[model samples]
Target: MPCAPTLAHYWLAETLRLREALWGPLEDSGEVRRARAQGQGFGQKVLLRAQFLGQREKLDLLIARWTRGARLALLGMLAAAILAGAATAVGALGDGSRSVNVLLALTAMLGLNALAFLFWLLSFAVRSAGSGTWLGELWLWLTRKLARGPDAALAPRALVEVLSRNNALRWILGGISHGLWAAALLSMLLSLLAVLSARRYGFNWETTLLSADTFVSLTAFLGWLPSLLGFAIPPEAVVRASNGLQALPETAQALWSSWLIGCVATYGLLPRMLCLVLSLLMARRNLAAIGLDENLPGYAELRGRLAPPSEKAGIDGPDTPGFQAHFRPRAPAPHDQTQPLLAGIELAPDTPWPPAGLPAGVADLGIIDSRLERKNLLERFQRQPPGQLLMVCDAQQTPDRGTIALLAELAGLAGQAHIALHGQAGAGFSDARAAAWQERLAAAGFLPGQLHAGLAPALAWLAAGQPARPIAKDAHVQP
Candidate 1:
């Protein structure tokens, strides 16, 4: 797996592609224009571009753009950190008193920040703010600069219902937030040290309502770890002397300063640094899990272009006129149905699993993709096959030769089969892809009545098993 920074850089690159994908199939190049002219859709064009750029080139491009965006954000953060350090320095030691109240000065400098960190921890646990992460506003600005509006909706489809749906993106932003906090805390600590060196500043502690004993207990608690690290811890005498009732002697001032430094190191700087490291490790793990989601509409649509199966003419009859199929999205068929085995073959990215339309006994074989999954499905077919295997597929995906080949193979394995086109139907149908699927199925010896929209219709048709043609011997295979 790549390191945290490397993964973060790639995330920016993926975001760039996803943003451009929102623009749909538009292209300025003559080659792209020609591809579009030849009935190649917007998605296939994007895949080709990705291929042309190559993986290494894509990484390089992402690094360049990621660095530019990082630099802008870093510069802004640096300004904020410097300003904060300067303000806190002046606030901490600017008093003309020979001895500064250690409690009062440190609290003034770190109290609000500690409170803010606590609130941050609360928000992290809840994770309710997906799109509004700590750096979300900055990320949004960078997005707008990279492209125009990531429009509210894409009609037939949308970009992961907006970028926030990308969990990987949110995790990356979390790591970035940890890094920013670390920078701010470390800067504040360094600035405080620098200010102290410039003048003879005395540090003391004084609280009005609290007695000397109260502070003694508190100091002992706060300094336990610091003391273990060999840092000096003030005794009860020092705590009593800093009760704001009396000015401490010169020697006591140095002891108070050492105690204050120890508290800041243990409570402030070290914690932030530790959190930052943990965040980076988590970010790396998440990045390593991200893969090109081929199930997405964008990638699904490119099936034909990416893996066009070998042309074995007549495998599916040539005369299919167009890609349109006899499929439309309809109300879910009524529920009184004998359960047919359900299997989804790369259904659309948005299609819900354990499909909504089926009956109770429906066994979902999952979306078929990898060789292992295919092997499992085949094994199940032999183990306990259904009357009819309802193979679900995304209509938006062009039923390319490779797709048809798989469908044909699966159909041969089951006793009986049908194809349920999930996404592309009715108003959203694509003529070219639909026609291709129809011709392929026809040649594969699969017929209508054998076909339906989803589990709902497939079950309904099976329950009503009407005046239909008897299946060919080849159509009903032995398990």
Candidate 2:
């Protein structure tokens, strides 16, 4: 009703005012410090700060926020000026006032307003895209200066907490802001039309503006009333009424009235829902933007513990037999289950490695493989379990005789072992040989799961630790 441009000015000014009043005071004082600490990123900080502001003071904060918001009115005016100029240009481009010059101008103004509105909407989304209210961080993400960790798995609690804190008031204000933008755009268009009509078609500017203002104001009033009523009425009551109408035969009037009610609900509820969703998504992105997802180290100061062994040590390698005389084992707690597994090994071709070499009761063994054996082992164990921690000693791409021999030994040691190759897609072996080996393994009931593609992700996953069960059974694997 106030015209879109005027409304935009009002809302932008109001938002800035609210931000300054609510956030400014807290920032000035120390209350923001605690709030800041609670957040992982800028968005969280703003949300926490807002929550804190809500608790301490109310009226003064609101007034201050609006005071700061007044500045944005200037921007709204600039937008209005742009719209006016476009309207004039369109009027001139058309056959001057003789035909539909005035209408052309109005149409051009509307188009300009629409473009401006589009940009405003996009900017809103971009600014609020991160995990927190600190718009600056989101800006950084847009610019790609900061590379955040995976956004997909980030937690949503920070967002949820913020949205749930002051949802009703928050959404009301957010709707007002949106309405303001809409109004400003409309105002600019309306004003441009009035000015162009007066100049081109001898229409009275004052009368046109006054009439348009009255019409728009009345429309705004109607919209505002219904929206307010819908929001004020309990959601359950509306839902119940909607449900009851489902059983009744629909008259045209009844259908139209129901449709009107539905529209009211949509407009009233959509703003709140959008705000909540935007807040959450922005918070999530912000969290990732600030490295919140990383595994930060513990706070304990362990630098002293990591120093090299001093004069107290006899042989340097006290953990081994040659150095064992220098060190005495600390007495262990009877209940402790963390003792390192002691092991001894001896290898002979006559006997199997596991039974012949490995000491009984050893918890685990660490084996190094030659590239060939590693490749052969991978190929053999591709789809099946290697039974033991079979170290493949072959290059998966280039399988040699030595690697084949290692695989054969592993196959003997474990009845169901398969090779795990590490080679380029079509490099190491003849296609026929590779196909034959794959077919042989397929017949033997062994198949490869996902193989390493590039070195990094593969190594990272392996370093993180393998799944307890077969990869297919692992939740991390896709169906």
- The TM-score leader among the candidates is 1
lDDT of 1 by residue, 1-479 (tens): 22122433334334435544653431212222223333244444444444332231343344445456556766676567667755775677775555676777778767866775686677657857553345534644554454322331221012223223446555555566656656666777776667666667766665668677878898888889988877778888877777666766877766776777777777777776786687677666655665444566555654554344542223332223221121211222333123556778876656678766456665666788765676566555434444556687776676665465566556644555677666634554555555556566775456755555434555554445432332232231111
Error of 1 at 316 (Å): 19
Taking all chains together, the TM-score of candidate 1 against the true structure is: 0.52
Candidate 2 TM-score to native = 0.20
Instruction: Give the clashing pairs for model 1.
Output: 100-204, 101-204, 102-204, 322-435, 323-434, 323-435, 324-435
TM-score of each: 0.52, 0.20
User: Using lDDT as the measure, which candidate wins?
Assistant: 1
**How many Å off is the CA of 63 in candidate 2?**
8.9
State the C-alpha lDDT per candidate.
0.55, 0.33
